[model samples]
Target: MFDVAITNGLFFDGSGAPGAIRHLGIRGGKLVAISSEPLEEGAQQTIDAHGQWVMPGFIDMHTHYDAELVAAPALRESVRHGVTTVMIGSCSISMVLSGAEDCSDMFTRVESVPREHVLPLLQARKHWNTPADYATFLDSHPLGPNICSFLGHSDLRVAVLGLERAVDASVRPSDAELRQMEQLLEQALDAGLLGLSSMTNPWDKLDGERQRSKSLPSVYAPWREYVRLNRVLRKRGRIHQGAPNLVTKLNVFAFLWESMGLLRKPLKTTLITLMDVKADPWLAPILGPLTRTLSRLTRADFRWQTLPVPFVTYADGMEFVVFEEFPSGEAALHLASQDLRSELFRDPDYRRRFREDVDKRFGPRVWHRDFDDAWIVDCPDQALAGHSVGELARARGMHPGDLFLDLLVEHGPRLRWRTMIANHRPKVVEKLVAEPATLIGFADSGAHIRNMAFYNFAVRLLKLVRDGEARGQPAMPLEQAIWRLTGELGEWFGVDAGRLALDRRADLVIVDPQHLDAGLEAYHEDEMEGFDGLRRMVNRGEAVRATLINGRIAYRDGEFAADLGQVRGYGQFLRAG
Candidate 1:
């Protein structure tokens, strides 16, 4: 007998096709049938998805859940929103091939997760030393969703070169060291990792007393080192998740060129982001066309990840990564002591340099840096009374840059402010997401804990399309939207997921399209259960009526199964195909 049956549901099948009313039978963690015929009546459980749209569960291809997957394997935050698969080891951080301390240092600062919680958990439980063992560790845990990961370049580099030497800018890997890295990557691929994820973004820093403020180890590698590793991925027909040196942005073409098959088999490259930033209005318009040209003309297979919704980011005093874009801001953050940063914030010389940079408005910044664009969302000081940074600066007759530094000196971390960094222009954002060379991503889920809240990005994208179609300006077909979050990504990543074919793994969600609305944008907080009262920003919505991972209803009827991560039924480690 089938374990479950979903009847009269609008099935999308993750194929970018129109949804059709169908009945699906699930048996033994696989799809039993995909047909319009009536489901045989004797299923042990049944879901009457009368009006709901059933599709393959959304795949979250960008997440920093590497540590959280260890701390709380359920990871209900993404699962609740219909994400049944989560990709970790993003931005050159992964748990494989590194010691607990090294992994913790590499991750905590860049991802903004608490090291105190992550480090100790790893120190106690992290015994695995290789990619295969890491996969085994995950299998032992009651994972909430299928997990796929890239072998982080930083992890391999640090493991082979020692953390001290890896982060040192002057220390280049020897030929021997490069071979070791390749060997580790080969091991990772053999262990079924998605591929290699590398970082050229200098803003992502390492944590720990020794490596503090140093950019991730991947940032220390030279172009030759990267090319050597990229070859391994290319040869294996694996993906390369890359981020350009954002400060310079010249590396973008370098990555794209490597993705071309003109001289060799194209490496399937997917880069971090393409957004309509307020700081550079011309960038997105140019990039969309250029990327499409490269994709078609070069016979290259690469996709620029795009966020489908508005990019709102939160910052507390001076703890945001955008600061790393400029010298003065980076100097302040480089200080290990919070008091030192505060003192530097008030230093006249430092302020002079920062103000000069602000006036010049440095090229290629994600944040607009306009004080008017940022607002004080929370502050303990009663006198300021929730004014935008620009208002406070204007009141004091000081430049917004100068006033912002002064605020940091006084109310660090306690003073929370938010800004719409990019993707704020709805029409422009709609077009950007629709680009053929772009993929629906950059959700940055499980990263930027305080700074971002795009957990429901999939639903938000759906909502964006739904709202647009209602106004008679459809960005693309709704079926296409679902496919972007589902089959497109799953196919690209080579995961055994994101389709509702008969006999396929029963991984799907029931989305209530009628209830999908603006409420999905609302953000709230849930205290991270094991993390010493740390509150994480999360999205809450009713659109996801049910999420089934491998034939089990992990979340349904507005409630998560109580035993989710405590039991093995919810999910298991999913190796890359």
Candidate 2:
């Protein structure tokens, strides 16, 4: 008898075959049969999958759960979205310990993880002291879904060379240091880490804030290590990196080419979301030529993922304030940057240099642009949710800047606004989404805590592609979208499970796609730590009826089974084996 059976279901197997009407029989948590034949003796349980779509569980390739995973391993946010497996340690930030030295300073500077949040956790509950040991800790925990990590290059840089010295572009590592990092990478790979990942960007606070003064060395570390590590991995595992900054576009293109050259094998490297911004018009200019060259000459593989949404939702009255605008707004921000931000604020000549180099070139554009009263979708306070800060300002007869400043001042560092400025038009999204080499992603779920609304990416795809099909400009086929979100991602990463094949691990999500709406649910304060409100989210397959990991139910109905004692350690620790 089968352990479970789903009858009358429309099954779209991960192989891209046409949908077939069949009943799926699960035995020992793997799909054992798909036939019209009546049940053998007696199945333990059955589900009427009627009109629902059943496919492989999703694989989220890009995520930042560095600190959060240490606290809550159930991974509620991802499992809720039908994501059965998630890859973290992207953008060169890793949670693995390095000897007895306090690497907390490295995280604060490179990744912006708050010292308060990281230090306390490291001092208290963090048990692992090396990459391999950290992987062991994750294996020991009761994780709800499968977790495979990458050895972040930033961590490697700090481990080999001190954080202070690793940033220098010319500071080539000593042969011993290089060998040590290589050994560390080998250890992590043997411990089951997927590959290495990194990101490159200079600091700039969006919202038309002041420019971040001084160039740091960490920026060069990621690019240098990309070539070094790819040669070592020999394309055994994939490399994931994010390169969205305009200032570094040229550098990014060069580094991408360098990494591809080093691969010299049929291996894939995924570049993060190519944002739909006008300033980034050269995305195709760079990728188009590179694709042609790689197909004709190089045996390497290159791919990109797109978000199909704005960098941030502008409905929250948030807009990206480029560093170019910082000079004009320098006076206000510099005064504001005092005290806690005094390290950067203390340099008066640097502020003067910013003013001279910045304001002289872009004076009128910063002064005259009208961003007065734009409609907003959600706010921390429900009363102010839909109202614009500009409109509120006019009603109270104050300048829009004052209203914006007041909120930032009151909310302090936590103030954030979603923006629609990146790709203000749908045509841009359509063109990018239809590209063959592109996959749908850029759901920076655990990152950009105050600024980004990540849960909306899946819903946006449904709305734009499914609902907008009549326009004859749909992004991708629903079947392709499903595969891209699930099976394809796993195949790209060399993970074991992104399909419903027999003998494979059972990590699955049951989602109701129809009721999924394109609106952000208000903040619900129910995280494990009780850290106030987080934006409540529901995607196409959000109302997860059940989530199974390694043939056991990890989460079911509305509660996490790990917490409910339905299963013990349903998650499996994946190694290179």
Best by TM-score, which number?
Answer: 1
TM-score against native, each model: 0.97, 0.80
Residue 239 accuracy (lDDT) in model 1: 93
lDDT score, candidate 1, position 11 = 93
Per-residue accuracy of model 1 over 1-577 as CA lDDT, tens digit each: 7898999999999988899999999999999787788965668889999988999999989999888877788898999999999999988888999999999999988888878888998998888999889888877888899989889989999899999999888998899999999999999998899999999988888888987888999999999998998899889999999899988999998998899999789999999889998899889988988988977899899899999988989887777888877889788777867799888887889889999878776576777888887888888887675678898888889899888887777888888888888887898999987898898887888888888899899988888899989999999899999999999998999988788898889999999988788788886878875577888788898999999999999999889999888878777677876
lDDT of 2 by residue, 52-123 (tens): 666677776677766666666666776665667777777666767442224444443233334466566666
Q: In candidate 1, which residue pairs clash?
A: none
Q: Write down the lDDT that model 2 would get.
A: 0.57
What's each prediction's clash count?
A: 0, 9
